[model samples]
Target: MVDFQEFCKHLPFGLLIVNYKGEIIYKSQICENLLNNSDPNIKHIQDILPDSSIIKVIKEGKFDISPYKLKEEMYLIQIALEPGKLGGILFIPEGVIQDIINASPRVLELKHELESIMNLSGELVTISDSNGIILRVNNACEQIVGVKEHDLIGKSVYEMEKSGVITSSSTKYVLEKKQKVTMKQTTKSGRRLMVDGYPIFNNDGSLNKVINISKDVTEISILKKRLEETKNLLDYYQKELYVFQKSEQEIVYQSKAMEKLYDLACRIADVDATIFLHGETGVGKEVLARTIHNLSNRKDAPFIKVNCGAIPESIMESELFGYSKGTFTGGHKEGKKGLALAAHKGTLFLDEIGELPLNLQAKLLQLLQEKQFTPLGSTSPVQVDVRFITATNRNLEEMVREGSFREDLYYRLYVIPIAVPSLAERKEDIPFLINYFAEKYSHKYNHYKTFHPEVIQLFVDHKWKGNVRELQNTVERLILTVPSSQIEMHHLPDKLINTKTKVRGNMNLKQAMEQFEKQILIQTLETSATMREASKKLGVDASTITRKVKKYGINIAKLQFLL
Candidate 1:
């Protein structure tokens, strides 16, 4: 009635149990600890100790106590048989069995060492039986799964998946395939785990156990995604930069003032000082900023432009200096990076710098002086390496005197000043500009057109109050309308025609009256939608409007669209 296997496990001497077929079924703790056997279960008794008579004694149902030598150590083997003919092999050393019991403390230490090995491992280790019942887990497993080791030890992996403790298990694959398997797993606590399941085989090549080594991969996955996104964004920026560079190669210039300005720009391009470009609104300040950036060593880096007056005052700070996560209502859950941070190791062009609000001017000054700025609602400042190029039509010095703009900020941004000439100052370049615009717009509108010599002279003589922008618009308008292959003097806007090209001309009264009549007819046609409208505006009938348009050779199709 007694359970002999349990009784033998408590004994000091080693004991092993084998079936009648010579297969090891059990091995006691003391036997494994003292013998230091990597595998406690040996299939045959002869394999444990060669030339053993223990199996013969079990077959004949006789008690045999004999001397046995194993690994050069003397031991006594006692063989017995159970009612069912199962074999029991007991090993006793040359000394008394009580001496082995006295060394029981050593066995306890060995057990503790095994536990320490598992507990100290950084990776999560989980052991399960061949039937997929969880038997044990290391300390790291508790932290990863958010469950106690004791709670998980007796449970089945299937039950855990059903109960939502873990999303899935890699042990199932090891059990089914009887080989090593690796898979991604997610726990109920939202930890991403990479689990490697290795199947431990018995001597008979059957599945004995499965050990899963898991590593938390949540942070690694997030970092990889961010890296991919950054790579893609960088590719996009590179393409845009290619386009910008190609267009910059097309800038045309012929005037002395423009030639001098370009030479100065090229000389200062490599310097790291702050550059301030001053010009009228229509003059090409932004173009000069691009020239400076392209000429510098940082040309390969980003060229970010922000219009201070265009961005609203409310979010300008956040737009300039990034904000932390959840810093404001409707903000991105993940923190946002600003243009300043995006422009690190590159150039940041702050156009219309004079229009920046007074309060934000101090922060701009901080970035200029300290090379850092704290984002809105953030305590820490982010440092940036940036070459600043600012452009504005406003007179910052006059504003500084009037207390409208900060004096300290003015000096900070005004380190190196370059003045761009207005369209009026470079009047000699008018003919060249006219031809350039004519070619540009003609190609854009899918046609060919040329300006008459008189028309070009008129443009050169006219006061371009709106500067280059006005001239560009005028040229595009003439190309788009003006139905003929040639844009003539009559195609000129009334404002340009009315302004005399020559101060003193050789025209007499007859020629002057005819020129005045032509100007009146062209101006009225431009302001009206139809001949009838022009006739009403000019205080004439439709027939007279029609006759004047033909007589003056005005492009009526151009007049209709202009209205």
Candidate 2:
């Protein structure tokens, strides 16, 4: 008979014996070879087969057979408790089932077909055992991760990470989670990768392998960054375009004072703070307020303008706070939403706010403080979401002192007080405004007209106490009523023509004389039909008058136009 050790080594299956303490007592030569262990003694069977069911078999004294996976191979294992002792024995077939399958011609063909499919993929594909050993990698792996198949295959992912071949591994996460995982990784080639890892399990519910599919997203990431930058640049240019268009259409100005004021308006446009516009009448305060509303986030909402001074005091409360149905005789049967409610989620411009009655000022103050107000005949307070932009020509501070305007209401409206300058203060913008309004009214009345130089000079010199409103009305009147295309000094209103040009600074005798002479020549040219008539009226030779006319740069054509 053969010796026991030799006979056990010659057996076709691998065997392991464990004592009741679950410590390995004996292992055959085939078992040692199958487990890839060369040691004479092993501490536990779990050291080789970590998922072994031998301990349960010993505890319950039961017998069971199951498939055990090791690395990339599968083996059928037989587990049974010892007949008379509190010990267990595990029988593992020496020939792996995967090896038997690999030997078949059909399985080999399918394996080659699968490998061809995997290598043909554009995305990097990798397979690693549960122990972190890389078993296979596709051809795309070299192009994406800059690693060769031979270099990564059979190598440990942890070692590759330590060696800096790849920055991180999704396989590590899959192993930890025992589920699918997706992560971003970088390689030594400086390529960004989006990797999705899937954990594959065996029939015994034990981790078998991790499959990682990776896509090179380096170009996509760069393109995304560039797209974001382009979008931001487009937004900036669009805003600049809006400001330019707005300046040309509305709030036309060129003076540094107006420029600075408009810049402040734009800066505070989007904020929800209450804006108080204070200026003289006809100073374009309403236009400026509308500009603010257009630039604000509520540009799409309603812009309700209520002239506090225009409405009568008796119905002012109902017009502002709205009234319920049948609140008063002859009232609308369905009731009105009122100016405040109509301007919901928008701007409410209360022009001449200082003219608001004392009692209504209290209600306005309540609305400003609490964002809610009661209708005239309603017991319940209706909420409102309105941005307040109030304008006044009167001094609210003086009114507050006189007990005419509410002190609390005045302070509430004074949160962001912006003083709009009168047109006379920004005289540099006068010529441009005149031209804009001239062209505007010319279009409105369907007549084209131009102002004579002398008429424009008179407009610039005259102190427009009525501000822009007076100037706009004058331009509209001239455009409508002036018979000729060229508007001269005689075409102006008597008030504008008779107005004396105020000498702004201290002038010497020569400068005063020259200015007086220029004015006389202009006036004489307006009345006189001919150059000879103007010279005779001045009691000067025609040549002297012509020399003074040239010196003063006076347009002799005005006399011709008048004729």
Candidate 3:
């Protein structure tokens, strides 16, 4: 006389039981809600679950479980066995299984976002279940793995590796070690691949899935071979002829934006037309100008650079065109040749050209047109053969429209315009730039160091207002200040570690004010030791600060320790 209905009443999942005669005996409260029926004895269990395997289990006197669909709803049917007899059948709804297996909404959203990112990524991406069954593959996999995504989706990585579909599998290693693994993989077509596998886990610490990212290093291998072949020959000649000249620091980058800029610069390097470079301050404008000069035919000749704003207005003309022996007091008595003359047969780079005075613009225009300029206190013009390269952080066209810059000069220098991208625009280059700066500074300071991966990730996500220069300076500072070999997050400057979120595009006044307030609160908390101190620093009461902190879910303990 067992009360089967009361037996599974408190379980989170629904449960139903039927006697071996196929008549419904008991149903849990959850099942009543799920099946939308309260009466279990009104009909035979066969009518409710017509295709259930419970009937077969009962007839064969064996326990069984199978999926049963009723009116577009799925349920699990489990048949129980009593001592020497068939017992009853139990039913559990599909929704209960989903709650046990599927992730939360936010987690699912993040997973979807990760998948989207992988889909758009340049590297080959493959994701597989814990058992090495491929679940998804990015478009890049089709080319690198030499198989269509659809063909690989449901296949096992072990079987694929055994069949030589892929030369190797990082997923297998990750599963074996239960951790991230990185190794070199070779393709059937003999392409060298750099593969990294990351293992994901469920909340209960069980294996979830494995994500594999691979890059084809075929071109890199070829370049390494070529370098090996040429290094000795170049070194011998450089030493024998005493022709070794220090090469300027090359632009460190691996981004598509930089690639486009490099290609554009190369295309126009041989041409002698005036080139104008435009970008934000510290975006490597001068480096690009130097790159152009070095790539040109006049690389061996003197390359003179002038900052128009740095020269006094009274001596600007004298500095550019040279002053005669007595043209001005305190001038070089030898009547030194100005940058224009000094750069003859080479290149002259004019930085901050937008800051040039109005009177000097006319002279600059004449020099461009006549290819000659009259020195101060001289009657005759001095002929010159110099290519002109101008750079400006300011908007020259806007200045021309506003009448501060000459329209003719603007047009003359705008022959070939190149725009250098900001650090934020080319975030992919952050890691390379960080590594370069870290190596340079580490060598200079006689200290070997490396950055924590999380620190590097923060640098990549930061909005570098000062562009490449700011990133380089930050890296140098970290190398010098960090006491340990590994630069951790705590070693970074407070400003960098607690940087406010950059507001992009446009926003309404209320939204702007909210962001500003949030930034202020964060800054105050970061610098202050306690809630009262933060409140006083921010010109607010302690209660107000506490209220706002709770609203924003700010981590007060971490903020207090940041200082």
What does candidate 2's lDDT look like per residue over 197-265, in tens digits? 999999999999999999899999999999999976774564456667743546777666887887887
Ranking by lDDT: 2, 1, 3
Model 2 C-alpha RMSD vs. true structure (Å) is 10.9
Give residue 348's error in model 3 in angstroms.
0.4
Q: What is the total number of backbone clashes in candidate 1?
A: 0
TM-score of each: 0.46, 0.59, 0.46
CA lDDT, candidate 2, residue 117 = 83
CA RMSD, predictions in order: 19.9, 10.9, 31.1
C-alpha displacement of 111 in model 1, angstroms? 65
Which residue pairs does candidate 3 place in steric collision?
none
Say what the RMSD of model 1 is: 19.9
Better of 1 and 2 by lDDT: 2
Which residues of candidate 2, in runs, are more than 4 Å off? 1-7, 11-88, 91-248, 263-274, 295-298, 357-387, 394-417, 446-449, 480-485, 501-563
Minimum summed lDDT over a 10-residue window in model 1 is located at 239-248
| Top candidate, metric lDDT | 2
lDDT of 3: 0.79
